[model samples]
Target: MRDLRARFRAAYGASGWHLLLLVGCFAVAAWVALRLAGEATAGRMLLWFVGAVVAHDLVLFPMYAAADWALRTAVRERRARPASGPSLLNHLRVPALAAALLFLVYLPGILRQGRETYLAATGQDQQPFLARWLLASGALFLASGIRYAFRRWRARRG
Candidate 1:
Protein backbone atom coordinates (compact mmCIF):
# COMPACT_ATOMS: atom_id res chain seq x y z
CA MET A 1 0.00 0.00 0.00
CA ARG A 2 2.81 2.37 0.90
CA ASP A 3 4.62 1.60 -2.36
CA LEU A 4 1.49 2.16 -4.40
CA ARG A 5 0.79 5.42 -2.58
CA ALA A 6 4.34 6.59 -3.13
CA ARG A 7 4.13 5.72 -6.82
CA PHE A 8 0.85 7.63 -7.15
CA ARG A 9 2.27 10.67 -5.37
CA ALA A 10 5.38 10.60 -7.49
CA ALA A 11 3.39 10.42 -10.68
CA TYR A 12 0.87 13.10 -9.67
CA GLY A 13 3.38 15.39 -7.89
CA ALA A 14 0.75 15.80 -5.15
CA SER A 15 -1.82 13.78 -3.26
CA GLY A 16 -4.80 12.40 -5.21
CA TRP A 17 -7.08 14.65 -3.15
CA HIS A 18 -5.45 17.71 -4.69
CA LEU A 19 -6.48 16.65 -8.15
CA LEU A 20 -9.97 15.79 -6.94
CA LEU A 21 -10.34 19.21 -5.32
CA LEU A 22 -9.03 20.98 -8.42
CA VAL A 23 -11.54 19.18 -10.61
CA GLY A 24 -14.31 19.98 -8.17
CA CYS A 25 -13.42 23.66 -8.21
CA PHE A 26 -13.39 23.70 -12.01
CA ALA A 27 -16.77 21.99 -12.07
CA VAL A 28 -18.19 24.63 -9.70
CA ALA A 29 -16.78 27.42 -11.86
CA ALA A 30 -18.29 25.85 -14.98
CA TRP A 31 -21.64 25.55 -13.24
CA VAL A 32 -21.52 29.22 -12.29
CA ALA A 33 -20.59 30.17 -15.87
CA LEU A 34 -23.51 28.17 -17.27
CA ARG A 35 -25.90 29.82 -14.86
CA LEU A 36 -24.56 33.24 -15.70
CA ALA A 37 -24.89 32.53 -19.41
CA GLY A 38 -28.60 31.90 -19.01
CA GLU A 39 -29.16 35.32 -17.45
CA ALA A 40 -30.16 38.39 -19.55
CA THR A 41 -27.47 40.42 -17.81
CA ALA A 42 -24.74 38.04 -19.01
CA GLY A 43 -23.17 40.70 -21.22
CA ARG A 44 -23.03 43.16 -18.33
CA MET A 45 -21.57 40.44 -16.11
CA LEU A 46 -18.95 39.61 -18.72
CA LEU A 47 -18.08 43.29 -19.07
CA TRP A 48 -17.74 43.61 -15.33
CA PHE A 49 -15.55 40.51 -15.25
CA VAL A 50 -13.24 41.85 -17.94
CA GLY A 51 -13.16 45.29 -16.35
CA ALA A 52 -12.30 43.77 -12.97
CA VAL A 53 -9.48 41.74 -14.50
CA VAL A 54 -8.10 44.75 -16.33
CA ALA A 55 -8.42 47.03 -13.32
CA HIS A 56 -6.70 44.52 -11.06
CA ASP A 57 -3.94 43.76 -13.51
CA LEU A 58 -3.27 47.27 -14.71
CA VAL A 59 -3.90 49.39 -11.62
CA LEU A 60 -4.53 47.52 -8.38
CA PHE A 61 -1.72 45.02 -8.74
CA PRO A 62 1.04 47.61 -9.25
CA MET A 63 -0.33 49.86 -6.46
CA TYR A 64 -0.53 47.01 -3.94
CA ALA A 65 2.78 45.49 -4.99
CA ALA A 66 4.51 48.80 -4.42
CA ALA A 67 2.74 49.29 -1.12
CA ASP A 68 3.72 45.79 0.02
CA TRP A 69 7.33 46.35 -0.99
CA ALA A 70 7.38 49.64 0.86
CA LEU A 71 5.79 48.06 3.93
CA ARG A 72 8.31 45.20 3.99
CA THR A 73 11.18 47.60 3.64
CA ALA A 74 9.85 49.83 6.40
CA VAL A 75 9.19 46.88 8.73
CA ARG A 76 12.59 45.35 8.05
CA GLU A 77 14.30 48.61 8.80
CA ARG A 78 12.39 49.11 12.06
CA ARG A 79 12.67 45.54 13.33
CA ALA A 80 15.57 44.36 15.49
CA ARG A 81 18.76 43.38 13.71
CA PRO A 82 18.59 39.81 15.03
CA ALA A 83 15.50 38.19 13.42
CA SER A 84 14.86 36.07 16.47
CA GLY A 85 11.12 36.47 17.03
CA PRO A 86 7.94 36.52 14.95
CA SER A 87 7.82 39.08 12.17
CA LEU A 88 5.36 42.00 12.26
CA LEU A 89 4.79 41.89 8.48
CA ASN A 90 2.02 39.29 8.58
CA HIS A 91 0.26 41.00 11.48
CA LEU A 92 0.14 44.21 9.47
CA ARG A 93 -0.76 42.46 6.24
CA VAL A 94 -3.77 40.58 7.63
CA PRO A 95 -5.54 43.63 9.05
CA ALA A 96 -4.78 45.72 5.98
CA LEU A 97 -6.16 43.02 3.69
CA ALA A 98 -9.31 42.59 5.77
CA ALA A 99 -9.91 46.33 5.87
CA ALA A 100 -9.28 46.71 2.14
CA LEU A 101 -11.64 43.85 1.30
CA LEU A 102 -14.36 45.34 3.49
CA PHE A 103 -13.88 48.71 1.89
CA LEU A 104 -14.09 47.23 -1.62
CA VAL A 105 -17.20 45.20 -0.87
CA TYR A 106 -18.98 48.20 0.65
CA LEU A 107 -17.52 50.75 -1.73
CA PRO A 108 -20.76 51.69 -3.47
CA GLY A 109 -22.51 52.29 -0.19
CA ILE A 110 -19.53 54.06 1.28
CA LEU A 111 -19.28 56.39 -1.69
CA ARG A 112 -23.03 56.91 -1.90
CA GLN A 113 -22.88 55.89 -5.54
CA GLY A 114 -26.44 54.59 -5.83
CA ARG A 115 -28.44 56.19 -3.07
CA GLU A 116 -31.87 55.70 -4.66
CA THR A 117 -31.34 52.05 -5.56
CA TYR A 118 -29.79 51.32 -2.18
CA LEU A 119 -32.61 53.09 -0.38
CA ALA A 120 -35.22 51.21 -2.39
CA ALA A 121 -33.55 47.84 -1.94
CA THR A 122 -32.69 48.03 1.76
CA GLY A 123 -34.86 50.93 2.94
CA GLN A 124 -31.77 52.24 4.70
CA ASP A 125 -29.60 55.26 4.09
CA GLN A 126 -26.02 54.84 2.88
CA GLN A 127 -24.86 57.34 5.46
CA PRO A 128 -23.50 54.71 7.84
CA PHE A 129 -21.30 52.75 5.48
CA LEU A 130 -18.27 54.99 5.71
CA ALA A 131 -18.45 55.22 9.48
CA ARG A 132 -18.99 51.47 9.80
CA TRP A 133 -16.10 50.67 7.52
CA LEU A 134 -13.83 52.99 9.46
CA LEU A 135 -14.89 51.45 12.76
CA ALA A 136 -14.33 47.92 11.44
CA SER A 137 -10.90 48.84 10.12
CA GLY A 138 -9.96 50.41 13.43
CA ALA A 139 -11.15 47.32 15.29
CA LEU A 140 -9.17 45.02 13.03
CA PHE A 141 -6.00 47.06 13.55
CA LEU A 142 -6.57 47.29 17.29
CA ALA A 143 -7.11 43.53 17.54
CA SER A 144 -4.00 42.79 15.51
CA GLY A 145 -1.97 45.18 17.62
CA ILE A 146 -3.18 43.54 20.84
CA ARG A 147 -2.37 40.06 19.52
CA TYR A 148 1.08 41.16 18.44
CA ALA A 149 1.73 42.71 21.86
CA PHE A 150 0.54 39.54 23.62
CA ARG A 151 2.80 37.37 21.44
CA ARG A 152 5.76 39.62 22.11
CA TRP A 153 5.11 39.53 25.85
CA ARG A 154 4.91 35.74 25.81
CA ALA A 155 8.08 35.50 23.77
CA ARG A 156 9.92 37.69 26.26
CA ARG A 157 8.60 35.67 29.20
CA GLY A 158 9.76 32.44 27.60
Candidate 2:
Protein backbone atom coordinates (compact mmCIF):
# COMPACT_ATOMS: atom_id res chain seq x y z
CA MET A 1 0.00 0.00 0.00
CA ARG A 2 2.80 2.43 0.89
CA ASP A 3 4.67 1.68 -2.36
CA LEU A 4 1.48 2.11 -4.36
CA ARG A 5 0.77 5.48 -2.70
CA ALA A 6 4.35 6.65 -3.32
CA ARG A 7 4.15 5.58 -6.96
CA PHE A 8 0.87 7.47 -7.41
CA ARG A 9 2.35 10.60 -5.79
CA ALA A 10 5.48 10.39 -7.94
CA ALA A 11 3.40 9.91 -11.07
CA TYR A 12 0.83 12.65 -10.44
CA GLY A 13 2.86 15.16 -8.33
CA ALA A 14 0.03 15.10 -5.79
CA SER A 15 -2.49 12.78 -4.11
CA GLY A 16 -5.18 11.16 -6.26
CA TRP A 17 -7.96 13.25 -4.73
CA HIS A 18 -6.24 16.50 -5.63
CA LEU A 19 -5.80 15.42 -9.24
CA LEU A 20 -9.40 14.25 -9.40
CA LEU A 21 -10.62 17.63 -8.16
CA LEU A 22 -8.42 19.46 -10.68
CA VAL A 23 -9.74 17.34 -13.57
CA GLY A 24 -13.31 17.92 -12.41
CA CYS A 25 -12.74 21.68 -12.38
CA PHE A 26 -11.28 21.54 -15.90
CA ALA A 27 -14.23 19.50 -17.12
CA VAL A 28 -16.69 22.07 -15.71
CA ALA A 29 -14.75 24.96 -17.25
CA ALA A 30 -14.72 23.20 -20.64
CA TRP A 31 -18.44 22.63 -20.46
CA VAL A 32 -19.07 26.27 -19.62
CA ALA A 33 -16.78 27.42 -22.44
CA LEU A 34 -18.61 25.19 -24.93
CA ARG A 35 -21.94 26.60 -23.83
CA LEU A 36 -20.69 30.16 -24.09
CA ALA A 37 -19.20 29.49 -27.52
CA GLY A 38 -22.65 28.69 -28.85
CA GLU A 39 -23.94 32.11 -27.75
CA ALA A 40 -24.01 35.14 -30.13
CA THR A 41 -21.99 37.19 -27.64
CA ALA A 42 -19.16 34.68 -27.52
CA GLY A 43 -16.84 36.88 -29.54
CA ARG A 44 -17.49 39.85 -27.30
CA MET A 45 -16.92 37.75 -24.20
CA LEU A 46 -13.66 36.44 -25.60
CA LEU A 47 -12.57 39.99 -26.45
CA TRP A 48 -13.36 41.15 -22.92
CA PHE A 49 -11.41 38.18 -21.51
CA VAL A 50 -8.38 39.00 -23.63
CA GLY A 51 -8.61 42.66 -22.61
CA ALA A 52 -8.78 41.67 -18.93
CA VAL A 53 -5.76 39.38 -19.28
CA VAL A 54 -3.77 42.11 -21.03
CA ALA A 55 -4.82 44.75 -18.52
CA HIS A 56 -3.88 42.58 -15.56
CA ASP A 57 -0.57 41.44 -17.01
CA LEU A 58 0.52 44.84 -18.37
CA VAL A 59 -0.96 47.23 -15.81
CA LEU A 60 -2.29 45.83 -12.52
CA PHE A 61 0.51 43.30 -12.03
CA PRO A 62 3.30 45.88 -12.05
CA MET A 63 1.33 48.30 -9.88
CA TYR A 64 0.63 45.71 -7.16
CA ALA A 65 4.11 44.19 -7.34
CA ALA A 66 5.67 47.61 -6.77
CA ALA A 67 3.28 48.32 -3.90
CA ASP A 68 4.14 44.95 -2.28
CA TRP A 69 7.86 45.55 -2.61
CA ALA A 70 7.56 48.97 -0.99
CA LEU A 71 5.43 47.55 1.82
CA ARG A 72 7.92 44.72 2.52
CA THR A 73 10.87 47.14 2.61
CA ALA A 74 9.07 49.47 5.02
CA VAL A 75 7.92 46.64 7.30
CA ARG A 76 11.37 45.01 7.32
CA GLU A 77 12.86 48.24 8.64
CA ARG A 78 10.29 48.54 11.46
CA ARG A 79 10.45 45.05 12.97
CA ALA A 80 13.00 44.80 15.80
CA ARG A 81 13.42 41.03 15.69
CA PRO A 82 13.21 38.45 12.94
CA ALA A 83 9.77 37.03 12.45
CA SER A 84 9.55 33.66 14.23
CA GLY A 85 5.98 32.87 13.24
CA PRO A 86 3.48 34.28 10.80
CA SER A 87 4.75 37.77 9.98
CA LEU A 88 2.89 41.02 10.55
CA LEU A 89 2.90 41.49 6.77
CA ASN A 90 -0.02 39.08 6.36
CA HIS A 91 -2.05 40.91 9.01
CA LEU A 92 -1.78 44.06 6.91
CA ARG A 93 -2.08 42.22 3.61
CA VAL A 94 -5.34 40.36 4.16
CA PRO A 95 -7.57 43.39 4.78
CA ALA A 96 -5.92 45.44 2.02
CA LEU A 97 -6.38 42.57 -0.45
CA ALA A 98 -10.00 42.04 0.58
CA ALA A 99 -10.78 45.75 0.23
CA ALA A 100 -9.05 45.94 -3.13
CA LEU A 101 -10.95 42.89 -4.44
CA LEU A 102 -14.26 44.36 -3.28
CA PHE A 103 -13.41 47.66 -4.96
CA LEU A 104 -12.51 45.94 -8.22
CA VAL A 105 -15.64 43.78 -8.21
CA TYR A 106 -17.79 46.89 -7.85
CA LEU A 107 -15.61 49.31 -9.81
CA PRO A 108 -18.40 50.43 -12.14
CA GLY A 109 -20.81 51.05 -9.32
CA ILE A 110 -18.20 52.53 -7.01
CA LEU A 111 -17.20 55.14 -9.57
CA ARG A 112 -20.75 55.56 -10.82
CA GLN A 113 -19.26 54.86 -14.23
CA GLY A 114 -22.25 52.79 -15.32
CA ARG A 115 -25.00 54.69 -13.58
CA GLU A 116 -27.57 54.90 -16.36
CA THR A 117 -27.13 51.30 -17.52
CA TYR A 118 -27.02 49.95 -13.97
CA LEU A 119 -30.15 51.88 -13.04
CA ALA A 120 -31.94 50.79 -16.19
CA ALA A 121 -31.08 47.13 -15.63
CA THR A 122 -31.54 46.89 -11.87
CA GLY A 123 -33.92 49.78 -11.16
CA GLN A 124 -31.49 50.86 -8.45
CA ASP A 125 -29.23 53.82 -7.87
CA GLN A 126 -25.45 53.53 -7.83
CA GLN A 127 -25.20 56.58 -5.57
CA PRO A 128 -24.31 54.56 -2.44
CA PHE A 129 -21.42 52.63 -3.93
CA LEU A 130 -18.64 55.11 -3.21
CA ALA A 131 -19.72 55.66 0.37
CA ARG A 132 -20.37 51.97 0.95
CA TRP A 133 -16.97 50.97 -0.42
CA LEU A 134 -15.27 53.60 1.72
CA LEU A 135 -17.11 52.41 4.80
CA ALA A 136 -16.28 48.75 4.13
CA SER A 137 -12.62 49.58 3.51
CA GLY A 138 -12.48 51.60 6.70
CA ALA A 139 -14.07 48.77 8.66
CA LEU A 140 -11.63 46.21 7.25
CA PHE A 141 -8.67 48.32 8.28
CA LEU A 142 -10.20 49.04 11.68
CA ALA A 143 -10.68 45.31 12.31
CA SER A 144 -7.14 44.52 11.21
CA GLY A 145 -5.81 47.20 13.55
CA ILE A 146 -7.82 45.82 16.44
CA ARG A 147 -6.60 42.29 15.76
CA TYR A 148 -2.98 43.50 15.60
CA ALA A 149 -3.37 45.37 18.90
CA PHE A 150 -4.86 42.31 20.55
CA ARG A 151 -2.02 40.13 19.31
CA ARG A 152 0.51 42.63 20.63
CA TRP A 153 -1.25 42.75 23.99
CA ARG A 154 -1.17 38.96 24.22
CA ALA A 155 2.48 38.85 23.36
CA ARG A 156 3.28 41.38 26.02
CA ARG A 157 1.25 39.50 28.61
CA GLY A 158 3.00 36.26 27.76
Candidate 3:
Protein backbone atom coordinates (compact mmCIF):
# COMPACT_ATOMS: atom_id res chain seq x y z
CA MET A 1 0.00 0.00 0.00
CA ARG A 2 2.80 2.39 0.85
CA ASP A 3 4.64 1.52 -2.35
CA LEU A 4 1.49 2.09 -4.43
CA ARG A 5 0.93 5.43 -2.72
CA ALA A 6 4.52 6.48 -3.36
CA ARG A 7 4.31 5.53 -7.03
CA PHE A 8 1.01 7.42 -7.41
CA ARG A 9 2.52 10.49 -5.75
CA ALA A 10 5.58 10.34 -7.99
CA ALA A 11 3.41 10.08 -11.12
CA TYR A 12 1.19 12.93 -9.96
CA GLY A 13 4.14 15.17 -9.20
CA ALA A 14 5.71 14.42 -12.56
CA SER A 15 2.44 15.17 -14.37
CA GLY A 16 1.22 18.17 -12.33
CA TRP A 17 3.58 20.77 -13.72
CA HIS A 18 3.20 19.54 -17.30
CA LEU A 19 -0.61 19.67 -17.02
CA LEU A 20 -0.46 23.19 -15.62
CA LEU A 21 1.84 24.29 -18.43
CA LEU A 22 -0.47 22.79 -21.03
CA VAL A 23 -3.50 24.53 -19.54
CA GLY A 24 -1.66 27.86 -19.40
CA CYS A 25 -0.63 27.49 -23.03
CA PHE A 26 -4.17 26.56 -24.02
CA ALA A 27 -5.56 29.65 -22.24
CA VAL A 28 -3.06 31.91 -23.98
CA ALA A 29 -3.81 30.34 -27.36
CA ALA A 30 -7.54 30.76 -26.90
CA TRP A 31 -7.12 34.35 -25.83
CA VAL A 32 -4.85 35.08 -28.79
CA ALA A 33 -7.24 33.43 -31.20
CA LEU A 34 -10.15 35.50 -29.94
CA ARG A 35 -8.10 38.68 -29.73
CA LEU A 36 -6.57 38.23 -33.17
CA ALA A 37 -9.98 38.25 -34.80
CA GLY A 38 -11.11 41.29 -36.77
CA GLU A 39 -11.14 44.54 -34.84
CA ALA A 40 -11.67 46.53 -38.05
CA THR A 41 -14.45 44.46 -39.55
CA ALA A 42 -17.68 43.10 -37.98
CA GLY A 43 -15.80 40.56 -35.82
CA ARG A 44 -17.54 37.71 -37.62
CA MET A 45 -15.02 35.14 -36.43
CA LEU A 46 -15.74 35.82 -32.77
CA LEU A 47 -19.46 35.63 -33.46
CA TRP A 48 -18.94 32.26 -35.15
CA PHE A 49 -17.00 30.98 -32.16
CA VAL A 50 -19.71 32.11 -29.77
CA GLY A 51 -22.40 30.52 -31.91
CA ALA A 52 -20.43 27.28 -32.12
CA VAL A 53 -19.98 27.14 -28.35
CA VAL A 54 -23.67 27.73 -27.71
CA ALA A 55 -24.68 25.18 -30.33
CA HIS A 56 -22.27 22.59 -28.94
CA ASP A 57 -23.26 23.14 -25.31
CA LEU A 58 -27.00 23.80 -25.60
CA VAL A 59 -27.92 21.64 -28.57
CA LEU A 60 -25.35 18.94 -29.23
CA PHE A 61 -24.54 17.98 -25.65
CA PRO A 62 -28.14 17.83 -24.49
CA MET A 63 -29.28 15.95 -27.59
CA TYR A 64 -26.57 13.33 -27.23
CA ALA A 65 -27.09 12.99 -23.49
CA ALA A 66 -30.85 12.52 -23.87
CA ALA A 67 -30.36 10.02 -26.68
CA ASP A 68 -27.84 7.96 -24.70
CA TRP A 69 -29.97 8.07 -21.56
CA ALA A 70 -33.13 7.13 -23.44
CA LEU A 71 -31.43 4.21 -25.12
CA ARG A 72 -29.96 2.96 -21.83
CA THR A 73 -33.24 3.32 -19.96
CA ALA A 74 -35.14 1.60 -22.76
CA VAL A 75 -32.64 -1.23 -22.71
CA ARG A 76 -33.15 -1.61 -18.98
CA GLU A 77 -36.91 -1.59 -19.37
CA ARG A 78 -36.69 -4.09 -22.20
CA ARG A 79 -34.66 -6.40 -20.02
CA ALA A 80 -37.43 -6.31 -17.47
CA ARG A 81 -40.13 -6.91 -20.10
CA PRO A 82 -38.15 -9.34 -22.31
CA ALA A 83 -40.45 -8.57 -25.24
CA SER A 84 -38.95 -5.25 -26.33
CA GLY A 85 -35.22 -5.32 -26.36
CA PRO A 86 -34.19 -2.15 -28.14
CA SER A 87 -35.30 -0.12 -31.10
CA LEU A 88 -33.29 -0.65 -34.27
CA LEU A 89 -32.34 3.01 -34.34
CA ASN A 90 -31.42 2.86 -30.65
CA HIS A 91 -29.07 -0.03 -31.38
CA LEU A 92 -27.47 2.05 -34.13
CA ARG A 93 -27.33 5.27 -32.08
CA VAL A 94 -23.75 5.20 -30.80
CA PRO A 95 -22.09 4.24 -34.08
CA ALA A 96 -24.30 6.38 -36.29
CA LEU A 97 -24.02 9.42 -34.04
CA ALA A 98 -20.28 8.93 -33.71
CA ALA A 99 -19.91 8.80 -37.47
CA ALA A 100 -22.11 11.85 -37.89
CA LEU A 101 -20.07 13.77 -35.35
CA LEU A 102 -16.83 12.70 -37.03
CA PHE A 103 -18.13 13.65 -40.45
CA LEU A 104 -19.56 16.95 -39.20
CA VAL A 105 -16.40 18.00 -37.38
CA TYR A 106 -14.47 17.58 -40.62
CA LEU A 107 -17.18 19.12 -42.71
CA PRO A 108 -14.89 21.62 -44.46
CA GLY A 109 -12.25 19.02 -45.23
CA ILE A 110 -14.85 16.51 -46.34
CA LEU A 111 -16.57 19.02 -48.60
CA ARG A 112 -13.28 20.25 -49.99
CA GLN A 113 -13.35 16.70 -51.39
CA GLY A 114 -9.81 15.92 -50.39
CA ARG A 115 -9.17 12.23 -51.10
CA GLU A 116 -12.63 11.94 -52.53
CA THR A 117 -11.87 14.52 -55.21
CA TYR A 118 -8.51 12.92 -55.93
CA LEU A 119 -10.19 9.55 -56.35
CA ALA A 120 -12.75 11.00 -58.74
CA ALA A 121 -10.11 12.97 -60.56
CA THR A 122 -8.26 9.66 -61.06
CA GLY A 123 -11.39 7.99 -62.56
CA GLN A 124 -12.24 6.16 -59.33
CA ASP A 125 -15.70 6.10 -57.81
CA GLN A 126 -16.34 8.60 -54.99
CA GLN A 127 -17.86 5.76 -52.95
CA PRO A 128 -14.42 4.94 -51.62
CA PHE A 129 -14.38 8.31 -49.85
CA LEU A 130 -16.42 6.83 -47.03
CA ALA A 131 -14.14 3.83 -46.84
CA ARG A 132 -11.06 6.03 -46.93
CA TRP A 133 -12.31 8.23 -44.13
CA LEU A 134 -13.23 5.20 -42.05
CA LEU A 135 -9.83 3.66 -42.75
CA ALA A 136 -8.10 6.85 -41.59
CA SER A 137 -10.15 6.95 -38.38
CA GLY A 138 -9.56 3.22 -37.83
CA ALA A 139 -5.83 3.75 -38.17
CA LEU A 140 -6.01 6.57 -35.61
CA PHE A 141 -7.96 4.33 -33.22
CA LEU A 142 -5.41 1.54 -33.73
CA ALA A 143 -2.55 3.94 -33.01
CA SER A 144 -4.26 5.20 -29.86
CA GLY A 145 -4.92 1.62 -28.70
CA ILE A 146 -1.30 0.64 -29.32
CA ARG A 147 -0.03 3.70 -27.43
CA TYR A 148 -2.33 2.98 -24.49
CA ALA A 149 -1.36 -0.69 -24.42
CA PHE A 150 2.33 0.22 -24.52
CA ARG A 151 1.89 2.71 -21.69
CA ARG A 152 0.03 0.16 -19.57
CA TRP A 153 2.65 -2.49 -20.26
CA ARG A 154 5.46 -0.11 -19.30
CA ALA A 155 3.66 0.99 -16.14
CA ARG A 156 3.14 -2.63 -15.10
CA ARG A 157 6.78 -3.49 -15.83
CA GLY A 158 7.96 -0.50 -13.82
lDDT, candidate 1, equals: 0.86
| Candidate 3 Cα misplacement greater than 4 A, ranges | 1-38, 73-94, 111-158
lDDT digits (tens) for residues 103-130 of candidate 1: 8888998888988888899998889889
Rank candidates, TM-score, best first.
Answer: 1, 2, 3
lDDT tens per residue, model 2, 51-141: 9999999988998888777777778744523344335776777788899899889898888897788889999988898999999999998
lDDT of 3 by residue, 1-158 (tens): 87876676687775555778989999998788777764665377668878899989999899888977776666665443334333333334545565667777766455555666666677664454566668766665565556645655665576
Clashing pairs in 3: none
lDDT of each: 0.86, 0.83, 0.64
For each candidate, what TM-score against the reference?
0.66, 0.65, 0.37
Worst 10 residues of 2 by lDDT: 77-86
- As a TM-score, model 2 comes out at 0.65
The numbered model that scores best in lDDT is: 1
Which pairs clash in model 1?
none
